[model samples]
Structures are given as structure tokens and as C-alpha cells.
Target: MPYPLNHWLATVGFGLAFCILASGNRLRAEEVDFVRDIRPLLAQKCFTCHGPDEGTRESGLRLDLADGLFGELESGAQGIVPSDPQQSELYQRLVADEDLRMPPLDSGQRLTSDQIGLIRRWIEQGASYRSHWSFEPLDPTPPAEVEAEDWVENQVDRFVLAKLAREGIAVSPAAPPQTLVRRLYFDLIGLPPTAEQVDAFVADRDPNAYEQWVDRLLASPAFGEHWARRWLDLARYADSDGDLGDKLRPNAFGYRDWVIQAINADMPFDQFTIEQIAGDLLPQATLAQKTATGFHRNGLKNTEAGSDQELDRVVRTVDRISTVGSVWLGLTVGCAECHSHKFDPLSHRQFFQMYAFFDNVEDVDLKTGHGKVTVATIAETKQRRETFVHLRGDFRQPGEKVRPAAPEFLHAFEPRSGKPDRLDFAYWLVDGDNPLTARTTVNRYWMHLFGRGLVDTVDNLGVSGEAPTHPRLLDWLAQELMRQGWSRKRLIKLIVMSATYRQSSQPRADLVDRDPQNRLLARQARFRLDAEGVRDVALRTSGLLDHRIGGPSVRPALSADITAYSRNRDWVVSEGGDRYRRGMYILYRRATPYPMLQIFDAPDTTASCARRDRSNSPLQALTLLNDPVFVECAQHAACYSDWQTDVDWIPQAFRRFLSRDPSAAELARLRVFYDHQRQTLAEFTEAQVRALCGESFAVASADQHDLREQAARYLIYRCLLNLDETITRE
Candidate 1:
């Protein structure tokens, strides 16, 4: 049986204590890796004052590179010497007295005994320093051999099982066929499978039934709708210009449809990147390609009276560059906007260099195939704007003149011509020599499938990001993505086919206490559906979903109190079938959000979202019980069963909502609850029974016994729809 909503959330929220059960054996068996083990420690503790950022360095000491660790300081003392810890100034300062410690008293930093020991051991073992993991080229070596070859399905499994063998843990068995069907449907298309579809898969005797289903779902139109929702979060796609005005963008849905069509066409990711970054600059670009440039126009805009238009443009440019860094490079380049970055190698000038790439574009409207519908997109101007570094990030105070360029620390920026534009910068991002794009993209797909990323910090992969638990696996996937011609569908299909993703999500008794975060990948991860996904599942199950692909975003009904946040102070509910459209097609006003969506933690669309938080609260439960959309769903689902004729309506309801048969104990408990509901309804008058059943239900001439029975069924279906298992991806 599944736990209560709050209990399941506490166990699987992805916010639990992090413990690397798989990497513990490596720490005990091999020498410490400076890049994986030591750099993150020093980068977190010492890099602020002693590393990078020349403005803050004290006493001419640097711990970020090998030269600084071993070189003699201005005071004529070596910070680190080969194979000697006692004499190394770095180690001595760490072990110094409270008053003379390395970080000093006011830095609010202290090293633990274990951390100090790791440093001393590194110095004693020759203090070797290699480049950071994210900066290095992908490792070309084959996957390591594993003893449990029976569990291996693809190269991904070999790497995963090898780690489990080293850690002395058994890999979990595959999940049952019924459970796998539901998992695939939600993971691929963000909907629940019909009961018949689940039964067909469970009864199929063919060996390739799962793979065949995988291919079919990948080709479904709904696949684009599901995947585009994730990309839109990264693009910060919203229907309105955010701020007090909150004016609606009438043509914004055109860009959303463009993304959907591109994914459905299986466009190569490299070409996808080039198109969005500089599609309009392409020679004789088509209308569809120009529409892809809407990625940058999705940033929040401020048109309030007396607001600084110049400052607003600068802010939009900053968001574009920062989003590019996070989405493609996985670096927090925005941290260096005001001053030099304290953690990574990005400098203030480098930030402006990136800013210059997006500085020359102007927003324009492209008239679409639809009558008079125009998409907002960016275009290059005839006149060039001189770029300069902003002093202290202020547009009024210009510092040094700069040009468009990539950060020099990673790869050499090669321009197509001397006068490079955003097109050259886009090519530089996807170049094979660049280490971050492939790795970052691979990790994002992995995070969507698995609950956590190979590097747990999905948005930042600089020195400060978490180390990959399976470093070789990450590199291998990155290499394979390029080898596959950057096909997202093929890569995603490859992942689900692996045995690592097919493992049962049931937690092991031994691992529950030790590996609460499930970083070991001994089994699959189970998590709740995203906010849009949660609503989609309910509408699909109720048989009320309008399966139309795309159009203008619909405005669902909202209460007066909730609609008061809108600029117009009211909402016009969509008519007919549009009222029951998918959650992704709902209008997302920045100032006035849909209460159910906001209560479930939907992104406000004010900034790029890497990962959304999953929280459980009384409000969520209350909304599920009382929200109009869900209440209508319950009414429709309850009507599907014949309360007067069918003796097994209770079992049918279970199969409809959960896509599975209920256990005997569950059936018995639900029967008792149903009986009590009927008894309570029996005491009400006929008019009261009709009022409770809702207007849509036919209760004009209702027999007393049948009215109470139908009302009881409605109450029972509502209880089932609110179940934790109904909303979770298991």
C-alpha cells in the first residue's frame, strides 16, 4: 500500500539528506582525486578569499591551480611542497590555532577534522591538481566490466552495476509489467494509460512488447506537448509581460507551437540551438525559423510609466546571457555581472563579452500563417551598437570596450569572420571541443527521467557543483549524444531501454536508513508528477480531456478573489471544449496566477527554472478536494459507473483512476466507506441529494434509493481521485 500523501512526500521529496553510498568504496580503496574530491571542498571554503578574483586575494596565495599551491609566496614561504604535509604552509595554517587559522576569525568558516585530513593526505600524496571535471574533455574509455552481466541491458547498465558491485549492493529486479506501462506513459507523454492499454501490454507474450510501446509513444503527438513544457520552463515562457501592467502577449502561443512542431519533427539539438539563438540571422531564413527566436523574447518586460527603458533592455540582455550560460554551459555566469566571480573562473569582462552577443538584437513581430497572428522575435539591426563593460553593473557607468566572445577558460572562441555576431557565438557553444553543452544537455534529460542529476546541481556545473556519482557514465552519455547526431528522441529512448531505468522503485529495507537520497541508482526513482502533469492525469482519467494539439491559451474559470490579481479584475472562462483543455494550454498571467497551479508550485515564469520544488501541504489537499476542475472530473468519473445496475462499480472505479485492480483489503475498506457515505446521504431530502450531485447529473426524477447510491459513488470517486498514488509517478 502507498503511504499517506505527507508521508510519501517526506520520503521521496528529493530534499532529504544526501549520501553517496556508491562513491564511499572509491574513497576507501583509491587515492583521493583532486578534481572530484578536493577541489569542491576548497572551492566552497577557501576560493572566496584565496582563489580567483584578484581583487580579493590576500598574501598572494591561490588554491585553484597547481602553480599557486606550490609556488613561493611574497613572504618567501611555500604554500604546498611535494610529498610533504608537515612543512606545507597550507596544511599548517589549516591546523593552526583558533586565532591564527587560515580563514581568519571573521570569515565565518571552519574546517572539520575529516576535511583537514583529506587536505593533508592530498599534500602528502604529491598534491596533484587536474582541471575541473566539467572543464575536461569527455573520457573515451569503454565502460568498466561488471560481474552481474545478467542485469545489463545497455552500456548504461554496465556502468551502474559496476558501481553497485564495488559497493556490495544488489541491483533491484525489474518492476512489474503493469507498473512499467504506467511509468512509461507518464514519463513520455505526461498522461495516464487507458485500462485497456495496460491490459494489452500485460498480456502480450512477445519479447519486444516494451520496446514497441516505447517507439509508439515517442511518435505520439502528445510527446511534443510533454517535452515542450520542460523546455518552456527553461525559456521562462509566459503569456504576459510581467510587472504591474501585466499586459498580455497575444501572439506568444505561436512560439509555443513552433517548439512543439520542432520537437515533433525530431530536429537535431545542434540545429535547434542555432535556430533559437540566431535564427533570423540565417541567410534567407523562413518564417518558421524566425519564429524560433522567441526564446529571448520570453524574458520579463517592464513598460510601467517612468521606468527606465535603457535599464530594462540591459536587464533583458543580462537574463538572456545568464540563461544561455545556465542552459547550455551549466555555469552561474550571472554571479560575475557586478564583480568578479568568487567561485568560478568567470571575470567581469567575460560577463560583458557574453552580454555583447545579445546586445545588438531588437524585438520584432513576424506575421504568421494564422490570420493576423504575429510572434514576437528578435532581429539584428542595420546599425551596430558599441559594447562596453558596465562599471559595477550600472549601464550609466561604462568601463572598457569589449566584443562578443566565449569565456577563455573553457574553449577558444572561433568566429566565422572578424566581425562576429550571435551566429558565431551559437556555433561556439555547440562545437565539439566545448566540454559543457553535451554534458549539460545529457544531465538535463537524465534528471527528467531520474529524480536527481548525475551532478545533483542541474543548473551549475562549475567548480562549486556537486561531483557526479558515476563520472564515467556521464561522459559516456555525453559522447553518445554527439555520436547519435544530437537526436533527443533516440537518446531518451536509449535511456528508458536501459535496465537501470527499469528497476523497481520499491525502497530496500537496508538502504532506507543509509541511502535516503537514492544516489546509488540501485533502483528507479519515484516522484510526484509536475504541476501541469498532475492536472493532465486527472482530466485524462475523467474522460473529459479535449485532445486537440495547440492553439491560443485558454482562460479557465477563477473565483473573484483569485481573479482580482489580474489587471482587468476578471477572467473570461473559455467556451465549450476549450474549457477542458490540457493544463499546458492554460493562460499564465504573471500577476494573476491560476490558484490550483500556483498551489501546486508551478513556476511563476519570472526566471528560468532548473528544478521545481515538490512540497506537500494542507492547501494542496484542500485544493484537490474543492477545486472546480477536479470536482467536475470526479462527477464525470463517478457517472461512468452504473450505480443501479453494476455490482462491481467499486472495482471498476479503482481500475479507471489507478489503472490497476485493487487489493482485497483495499476493496473491503472502500466498501465500508461507501456504505457510510450512503447512510449519510439517506438522511438528506431529494432536493438536497440533487444539489450535492451537481447540475450536470440527471436527478430530475430520482428514486430515493438510487439517488443516495449515486451520491455515495460520487463521494467515493472523489476520495480515489485525491489519492497519493493517483498523482505520483511510480
Candidate 2:
């Protein structure tokens, strides 16, 4: 049973983790010496046939729980005389069991001789049970400590340096200026620096050059475009509803833009979270804030004809709730949906409890009168979720009635408010006691800036998560997050300015051997550029990029064949068309994604994704070399080369793409291409040249599309623009 959707979020936050009987043993079985160890060993071997389950519980005993192990058994004799191996009844039963063997059955799965020896060894060391290390929190002070006069920055470094120092290792000094600049640029803005930007920092002699760079990057509008994208990916951003009928939601660009705006404004992280979760309910929410409500709406939807939309909607809510828990809390609360969490502290009841919080908020139809909108809703009918236990995860047979509540692990969170007041729910998440919310948020920031979180699993910081490399640093960052009134920008600036973040990705042989993974932040991790960055970089370098800010999304030109293959669509490219050049103008369709993005790890947006997987694949190679978009952008670059003017167009072209003058070698190659193209182009008459240039040329000896010289230049220019390094952030 679940609580009503119409209620508030407070219900689930309070008492979510119910105290259920813990299912697993609190300890592992102790070992025994051969005969003495043999007693228990025999029991394990014998227990399966006589184990704790139904058709068994054999030998008038069970082997499952501790209570059963000690209880009276058919063999009796108190199972074994305590501490007397020779007198143990179970031991005698096992070795003598060939005829009356206690195991009762033996096959290929029987224990080996070494196991019997280990059991004998176990008996020597008295058997004792202890829980897994993770269930409990660490002591106030870890046994280890790293104290460095200058290498350390925060407690995180202290912990890491302490460990390394204890082992006689040392962290490298600050990286050089070029490495630092590139690190900060990519970390905060998700783009590489222009050569000029890099040169400025390296050339600067100021001690505070790095700090100034940090401030500049965070303040730039590009910061939001980069970081909001990280958030959006986590929020499961998609342009269209998912599934067969996943039509593009053109207006979704508003939500994307809003996120960018929020980051640029340095909105308090808590408020940012609140706005995303329940911005619709915010008392003073502007249209942008309301637009943030689209976070929940960002998950998948099924709009196919005859699809059971209701089921899909509910699944999405569950996914949203699960995404929120995982993304913010680092708990796999979703695991408790059918049974108690097999490993963590969450229980099945808690899953529904949280599920109930989102039950009432509706994914309502936005259109009036039939067919007034762009896309239809997935579920044809809207029905309230009735509270019921989904028996064994099967909704058809509900077993228990439940109200919204929290999971058992954190055990004592009290929600001061109630249901669809999701705002209260959002507020509770931001509350101080909610350790998960802050830790997860900061860890995500760490992951974004450094390419990996101190706790590697950014989404799972709970017991199952890796112990924090710098627990103190993580805590300090979280505390700072709260102290600074949850300002994301301040946190980002702080990290970018840190010496740890500015290290070069270049490796030191010794450090490489000791810390090849670089999780310790000896240096910044080098990463290839993402899909959007690749496209954006091309356009920006080509001087063809339109920097005009927000408006309706621009529909980019696609190959006629590619467009024809999907939805029988078409896109015409024009030299000066309204949306021909901006990278952002490209449509992010749902069902039929553009090949360039699809191959570059773009999320399907059908689910809330906390991370967009970065994959290295061969297809990505083909897309860059052969994709129509790259081809067109390349052609656009070549358009700048005016051979008729007799100017050195290659150097000019290099400036547009590389942001610097070309090398003499590069200039030589372009000159050669130019000379060859012009000589070959002589065959074409002036009219044909004009025809090729998309203009009328007065010519005698020319092909139909006369402007062969210009066309050849554009084609060659396109090739240079599509090179790997040209698009990659590194």
C-alpha cells in the first residue's frame, strides 16, 4: 500500500527506514580445527538437504539462522561437546557418513579437502561472527593522517597525502601555467581555451593568475552552458517524449536555457534543487523557475498508439523518485521496490512510501481542444494512484497498505510537512540532517570538475559507495556548500582555484606507477571533448558560428538521405539561412537521433541519467569524417577562402579554425591545394564557375556549376575542419 499522491512529500521523509528484521547474518561463521572444525563443516555440507527452507529443515534441525544452529537436533548430543573436538557428535556424523553420512548426499559440488583443512584451522581460532565493515560509520578520527606543510590544501589532501606519506610517497608540485589554464577552462566551462587565452595565462607573471582565471570562467555565461548540461544529463534531459512516439519537444530548449541561466546566476544549490523538484510550487517562481519543473517531465514517455500510458507514467514517477534518491542521496532506494534492499538498509515498504510522494503530482495534458499541441501525452487516461502493496512486485495483487515514509538505513529523518507539497519534500532533502543530499551534490561537482568523484561512484555514496578519499575534504566541501548558502558558483570557483584541480594531465613515471588512475588528483585527468563541444568548437573556430543567444531552437541542416531515412523529413541548407550555423540549433530528436550525437554517447533521454557514459568507439571516427554536418561546416569554412582576391587565404583560414596563425608547413599544404585547384578549375567556363559558386559567373569554358575553383577550396577546407584534434577539447 502507498500513500495518496495528493498528499505532501513530508510523509515519506519521516520514518522511511522502518526497523525490519535484518535478513542477513550479522557475522561470518568462525573456523574450526579438522575434527572440531569438522563439526560445523559437516553441518554446512549436511544442511542443504537439511537446511532452513521448506522441504528441508532436515535432521530435525535447520542451518539458516544462528538460533537454528544452536537449537536441538536429531543427532542431539548437544551437537558437539563444547570445546571438545573428539566428542563432537556432528564431526563423527560427517567422517562416518559414507553409510549413515550426515551430508546425506554427495556430488560434483562437494567441498574439497582444503576446505576441510580450513574448517580444522577455523576451530583453532574460535568462531565468531561480525557484520560487514560498511554497516557502521567510521571513528571520529581515521587511524591515518597526512601532514604536509604546503602540499595539503583541505582535509581531503591531508587524508590522501597522509596515506601516501605513510608509505613514503609524495604528491607533485603545482602544474605549469598552460596545464593549469586548460584544466580550469575545461573543468568549469567544459571547453578548451583559445590559444590566445592559454598564452595570456602562461605569459602572465602574476601569482594570482590562476585565481583570476577561476573567477573569469565561473562568471562567464559559458559556465552555465557547461555545468547545467551536467545537471541536465543527470535530470535525464531529452528533446522528445521517449518510446515509439517520442516526438521532439521543441520548447524543451526553454528548460535547457533556464538551467543555464540558473547556473550563471549562481543560484544557491539548494534553491536550484528545490526549483527543479518543485519549482512549480515556489511562491515567487518566475516562468524560468516554473520551467525548471520540467525536470520530472524530462524522463521518458510513451505516446505510441494503443500504449498503456498510465503504466508508463507511473513507471516514470518511480524512475523520477529513484533518480532523485540515487542522484541526490546516493542510495539505491529503487532496489527496495520489490523486496527489502538485499544489501543496503532500505526496505520494500520504503520504496512505496517514497513512491507515494510523487503519486499525486500529475503529468497533465497541456493542450486544450483536441489536437492543439505538438505532441500527445503518453497515457491516454489519467488515474490517481491507489495505495496498495505490489505483491512480489506484481501490481495485480496488492498485499499491504502503506503511507509514504523514508528508508530504514538513515533511520530517523522527520519530515515536518506532508505530500504533494513536493516543495516541502524538496526542502527536507536540503535540510542539514539529510547527509546524502549535500555529499552527493558536492561529489557530483567534484566529478564534473575533475572527471571523477573522490568517491568514484558519484551516484552511490551510501554504505555501498567507496570510502571517501578525503572524507574531511568531502565533509568540508559539503559544509562550505551549506555555509555559503548553497551557492554552486562559489563552490565551483573554489575548486577551480585549487592547486589540486590545476595539475597537468601529463604523467610522472613514478606517479604513474603508484597512481596510474590519478584518482588522488596528482594531476588533472585528460578527457576528449563531448559531443556538443565537438560541434560547437568546429562552428566557433570556423567564424561561421552564430553567437546570437536564446530563442526558439534552430533546426540544423541534415543530409537529405539521413533525413529521408527517418520520418521522411527534409532540411534545406542555405548560406545565410536563419539557423544554418549555430551548433545549438541542431535538433535533439528522441527516436531518430542524429548520428553524430548518437555515436558520441548522447543519452537517449528515455530515463533519468545521473551520468552520460563516455565511450571510445570506432563509429565516432566515421561520423567525424563522413557525417553531413561536419561536411557542411567544413564547406562553410572553405567559403572564407577567396582565391580570386590573390590574398593568402590559408593563413586566414588557420586563424578562423585554430585561433592562431598557421605553421609554415600548414601554409605550404594549403598553397599547394590552392594552386592545384585553380589550375584544374581553369577548364570550367566563367558561367559554370558562377553556377558552382551559387552565383552567375560570366564565363566561356566552364562546367554547368562553373565555380570549380571556389568549390574545390571549400571541399578541401571541409576536410581540415573535420580533423580529430580540431573537434576534441584537449
What does candidate 2's lDDT look like per residue over 493-538, in tens digits? Answer: 7676555665566656776455666655666665656677776666
Candidate 2, position 198, lDDT: 66
Poorly placed runs, candidate 1 (over 4 Å): 1-31, 95-101, 110-114, 565-568, 640-644, 696-706
| TM-score to native of every candidate shown | 0.94, 0.73
Global CA lDDT computed for model 1: 0.84
Q: Spell out the clash pairs found in candidate 1.
A: none
Error of 2 at 306 (Å): 3.0
Q: lDDT per residue, candidate 1, 1-730, as tens digits?
A: 2244344233422121212233222223368778877888888889888887777877677778778877887767888887899888888889999877877768877888999999888888888888888998888468888877877889999988888887888888899887899999999999999888999989988889889999999999999999999999988999999987788997899889988888888898999999999999899998888889999999899989999998999999999999889888999989988887877888888899999999998999987777898988999877899999988899899999999898867889989999888999999989988889999999989999988898889998888787788889999998888899999999999899999999999988877755567788988988878888888877998888999998899987677766665364657889888989989999898887778888888999998888887777666766666778888888777666545565588888788778889899778777777777778888998778778767666532456776677778777777776777888888
Q: What is the lDDT of candidate 2?
A: 0.60
Top candidate on TM-score is 1
